[model samples]
Target: MVKYSEVIWMLVLFFLPSQAWAQQKVPILIYHSIDEFQGQGSKELYVTPENFEKQMIYLRDHGFSLLTFEHWQDTSKVKKPIFLTFDDGYKNNMKVYSIFEKLKTDQFRPTATFFVISDFIGRSNRLSKAELKKLADSGMVSVQSHTATHPDLTKITNYKEELEGARDAIKSITGKPVIAVAYPYGSFNSKVMEEAKKYYSFGLSTTPQYYSENGLKNELFLLPRIYIKYSTSISDFEKIVNGG
Candidate 1:
């Protein structure tokens, strides 16, 4: 005979949709310079502060939310969520910080990660240790590791020195746990991930895609990120967050 408990279980299963391995596709956008054409590839990584404001505004007005490293990572064995990150410690990021302070709302609070090079802090055109530390203390920014020398980790001869050294250096300055990493030049390999696990909770890459449970089993290690650019229009920005 069908008991009340058995009947309820059957009804729940019959009505509930399958969510076994399915995960929401979240974009982790990557940006580099927030100034004029200063880096390689004709300033591809650089986006003007004006344009940056527009993009942030676009995310604000739209339903898209800014996610932090802590937010994107899983706590209960779930897949990672959407994230936005910047690399290579540029000075103009302070402008982004100010804009975030003035414009962000509770519903639109912006969360971002900055991957900084340990040795390059306070070198001139880059952010100083004080600036980076302040941002880290703000509790809004997730300051992660970009290695001490910004070398391609996949090609490095010493994984322990490259991976652990950067984590240690950042923790010293920020007084926060450096749990995430962005590969210098967006480079990574299986062996690199193997060694990286010894130090980081997550790592990022420059690949143009989103994270899902069905792919990249180390979803934590090899997360894909969208490249925000100078020429990106509002429509293009919409398309990116909407996964176009």
Candidate 2:
């Protein structure tokens, strides 16, 4: 028997944007230090400059559009936008800028977000004020809050000190409005999300998955990002970017 409701459902599905039908997935890749530091720390956090360059080159050759976290709202213009974000503001993050300079093309402009610890700036192995200003001024890099001391949001006693406080500090240094934050330790709760709304327009989390405009419809604040670690090989990297 023919059903009127079935016909209407089919029409609605066909008329929606392909994003809904195809379930488009965008990879927001998260990185840390971009140096050859193989000492007594989390080795996973370090991706050698050579490997980083290779990854960026792969993206360029593959026709993926690179974007910073700030461009989340520019959905109308972006085509297959892939986010490259670095955490913890390590001094070696400048290597990111260097690699981008080498790979810039007429069709692609390299862009990334650097989530920094406001309290740790200017320390050994951490980004200094001068370095941060240079990266921010380049217009290719975005300096965002990773909390004032990189504390776990779920455990923090004062949200204002860690969240809004870091936003202000980065703004003072970079002279740009701080509108986003990558939660420290990828930790957040209902309370954290509530407070984050008071300061930031975008809140990035460390959950591992592919993001898309459709996904952002609900989970923009708790957006998931794929971690690019030292051990990530070329094949796995392809899978991550492809939303496998």
Best by lDDT: 2
lDDT of 2 by residue, 188-231 (tens): 88788888888998888989988755544337788888999999
lDDT of 1 by residue, 1-244 (tens): 9999999999888767565434577778888877767456657778888888888887777656577777653422433235778898888788768878877787777767899888888889788989988898877688889888888887878877778998998899899999888988889999888888899988888888976656566878888888988888878988887767
The 10-residue segment with the lowest total lDDT in model 2: 211-220
How much lDDT does each candidate structure score? 0.80, 0.87
**C-alpha positional error of residue 182 in candidate 1 after TM-score superposition, expressed in Å:** 0.6
Q: Alpha-carbon error at 35 in model 2, in Å?
A: 1.2
**Candidate 1: residue 178 Cα off by (Å):** 0.3
Question: Which stretches of model 2 miss by more than 4 angstroms?
Answer: 1-21, 213-218
